[model samples]
Target: MKIDVKVPAVGESVTEATIGSWNKKNGEFVKRNEVLLLLETDKASVEVVAENDGVLAIQVEAGQVVKIGATVGILDTEGKASAVSSEAPKTAPVTASQPTQAPVTSSPASAHLSPAVQRIVTENNLNPSQIAGTGKDGRLTKGDVLAASTAAVAPTPAAAPAKTEAKSKAAPAPAIFAASGKLSKQGEKKIVPMTTIRKKIAERLVEAQNTAAILTTFNEIDMTKVNEIRNKYKDKFKEKYGISLGMMGIFTKAAVEALKAFPAVNAYISGAGAGTEIEYHNYYNIGIAVSTEKGLMVPVIKDADQMSLAEIEMAIRDYALKARDGKIGVDDLTGGTFSITNGGVFGSLMSTPILNPPQSAILGMHKVEDRAVVINGKIEVRPMMYVALSYDHRIIDGKESVSFLVKIKEGVEDPERLLFGV
Candidate 1:
């Protein structure tokens, strides 16, 4: 019995994916639920698993574009394996008289070779068994085949020219030598095609720039009190929760309080004129902007205001790791009322964060630096961080935006306010 293995739908709006790599080779036995291939889509990379135990008969090649539900391979069921094995072609044993010459017929399975390897094999008319594989589990890699082809076609010593006369008339050894030092180094510039997430980010940034009256309000917070709390309880918190307590947890709590106090900043502009007053959300789903190798992805922690500090820290850590590994789901990256981005992690001093679309505002956190400040009319060194709030000016006035930032500053400076909800 032949079992068809098709590509499963990864997520909504994701219709196609490229075969990243195959974990198993054609004709190899695979177990049920074993990962067979890696599928790369616009948003994530997922493992394609075998549905049943059988020998894999791959129909598509790695790097080939396949649509959702497309057949990638066929599985030979238990009872049919013996029959399939019997049908395989019998080869004449190698001998001096036979010369071990290449066969005339090529297996249909050859059509499933990766493009890079396929091109080299077809151009050289090489047999699959002739070259040794070096990829995972001894599968033929692109580099392996290319190297094999190069060795086979290399010029022999007998074909070299015996002797040659130096030409005295050769044009003055061209002035090209003088320009060698001025040439640009290798890979000085590169133009890579944008990935799906990057393209989406570009579109969103442009939309935000064009649609909203964007404005940024800045304020600085003294980290003295916040650091004191963390230094006092970080060890206990980590031991109890199995996770480190970070500034994000403290900041998230402060942001939630500020959002509650300035309801208008948390609100979105739904309609125009009489129909549009302001739609305020009672719950806060804060978007935490995470930087990944592919690009920036914002995964929301739903109802963050209701979560404890430890819960918020764990959720952020989980989402960040998932986003970096390209395992975050569509639902994880959507639906947020506000966003927080920390450029300080990358050593940035300050930046005006762009708002995630539909969300009225975004908070930017910058690196902390020790600075002399007036304390009781006396100058003293204090750890301070500059915070910037970028908001839609149309919805939030300058006063409200400034006040909202000041509220966050106060809450962070005196974290006790977070406990009492002052």
Candidate 2:
């Protein structure tokens, strides 16, 4: 009997999923509960696993869409795993007549490569040894392989100057660049479809813009006191909690206090004028926007208002690790009262963040730099961070928005206020 490998339900909103990539090749023998493929839903990625020990027969290829209960592959229980991996290559006997050379074996670096990346390297007929690895411990990533492939084919387009002369004059150099802003692509462009998660993100962003009365307000935070706190307690905090103190937790706690003072920022308006309701949330579920290889995912920390600074730090840290490993679930991605995104991690000095629909507001954090500012009628250089609050003007008024930000500024600048719940 054969067991069906089906796409498991990830979330209520996720009706269908696209095959992100396959871990096991078609007809390959797999053990029970081994990962077969990664299923990409609109919210998060889920791994489909084999149910029984067997040879796998894949029904769907990568980039294809399938329903929640659809069988992506079939596992044959009778088929046995071969000794292909155990077989060793025969070598000539070493003798004094000829000096022995290192035994021929599989490349150690190849073991670190993912299935998708291995496929790319094989299809391009590229040598992994010649390519420089930028990943951890000099391991080749999918990106490194793509870069190497492009570099190898760099001379191909140049060799055809006569064929490109007509279009070269009319086309600006930037015209050939892809939407990703990659410069000077050497070969023909390949059209790739967006993943399920990317498409969902795009749809929501557009929905937020079209539906909500969006406006962004800016404020600069004096980081002198916050810096002192981090410098003072970061070590002890990490020692006690096993997680370093970070800005997200500080701001999240501060934001919670601010949210309590001005509930309008946390509340969202629903329905049209007459039937519209301003839904106020007593609990704080703060969504921390994480940028992953797939797209932007906001995993919410449920009841953030009740969590301590250290707890907030650990929660966000866990979410970040989960997002990185593609282990984050849809439940983690849903139901956030408010969101906070730090563009500062990518060296962005400032950005106007958009609202995550159903949620009234989002906090944008930016890079901190030392700047000269007046303090008690004296000029001094201090670390400063620019913060932006983007909200729906329909539910939250200008005064409410500005006051909420000021509350956040006060709490972070003076951590004592957060301690006393001021």
Candidate 3:
């Protein structure tokens, strides 16, 4: 019996997806529920799996636009997987007179590798034997290959001086302008079609610029107390929860409190003209903007207002790992009432975050630095972080935007306020 492999519906807003790389090829035998290919939609990447053990017959090639329910391939259940050799691969016999040598054959790790992992190995020219596999049953994962590649190819500091000395002895070359090279270079004249996710991002950003009155309000928070609290309990917190305490959880909680005080910031506009009215969300589903390889994805933490600090930390960590592994689902990316994006990890001191449409506002978090500030009658240095609230001016006024930011400032500055709801 043959079963058709169709693209499953990702979400209501998504009508179609671009076919990403296929994990298995035509005539390749795959087990039931094995990932066959990846579907790239605007919201998230969905992994399409085989229905049963079968030989795959690919119909639609990758990079092709495919609609939901469209058949991309066929699976013949009657086909069987080839048997593995029970004995280890034989090596050529060596005499005592010849120096002992290691076999040049490919590592057995290739059999256990996924399609993504195989691609990384081939592109980087990495030796699998030198890399210690941390995956199940000593199998190599994509992360393992990447880490090995980085370590293997990284230049040593001692070689830098000698290379510079050799360069100094060489004749100087003529300087070329960037535009001159860009226009004249034939090898660089290449183009690739945009992924579905990238296209959607472009469309939405333009729509936002055309449709909404976006404004950003900024404020700074003294992190002395928050840092003190973390320092006082980090070990205990990690021991109890099995995850480190981080600034995001505190910021997420603070944002939740601030949103409760300002209802308009949490409301979304529906309809047009007189029929238009603000739909206030009583529950908070906070979106944490996670940067993925394809594009930026906001995976909502549902009912964030109801979650504990530890729970929020766990959820944030989970989404981050999912993003790293390219496993975030469309369902994980929807229904967010508000969003928070931290550019601090990338050393961004400050940036205005754009709003996620239908949501009234987004909070931007920046890197913390020690700065001198006057406290009461004395000037002292303290750790401070800048925060920005970018909101729709149509729904949220300047006063509400500024005040909402102040609320977050207070909650973070005084950690007790967030814990006790003062």
Q: Which one is best on TM-score? A: 2
* TM-score winner between candidates 1 and 3: 3
User: Tens digits of per-residue lDDT for model 1 on 327-408?
Assistant: 6776787778999999999999999999888899999999999999999999999999999999998899999999889989
- Worst 10-residue lDDT window, candidate 1: 83-92
Give the poorly placed runs of model 1, Cα more than 4 Å off. 1-3, 18-23, 58-66, 78-183, 186-190, 270-279
Candidate 3 residue-wise lDDT, 1-422, digit = tens:
98999999989988898877667656678898899987888888889998889988778866779999999888989976443211112323556533343322345554555535654554454556666788877778778897877776555676678768876887353243253333334343435577688888898888777777899999999999999999999999999999999999999999999999999999998888532788998999999998865678889999998999999999999998787667889889888999999999899999988889888899999999999999998999999899999999999999999999999999999888887887
lDDT of 2 at 284: 93
| Candidates ranked by lDDT | 2, 3, 1
Per-prediction RMSD in angstroms? 9.3, 8.2, 8.9
Residue 32 of candidate 1: its Cα lDDT?
90
**Reference-based TM-score, model 2:** 0.82
Cα displacement (Å) at residue 312, model 1: 0.7
Question: What is the C-alpha lDDT profile of model 2 across 163-182, one tens digit per residue?
Answer: 47756676554667766656
Predict model 1's lDDT versus the native: 0.78
Q: What's the TM for model 1?
A: 0.72
List TM-score per model, in order.
Answer: 0.72, 0.82, 0.78
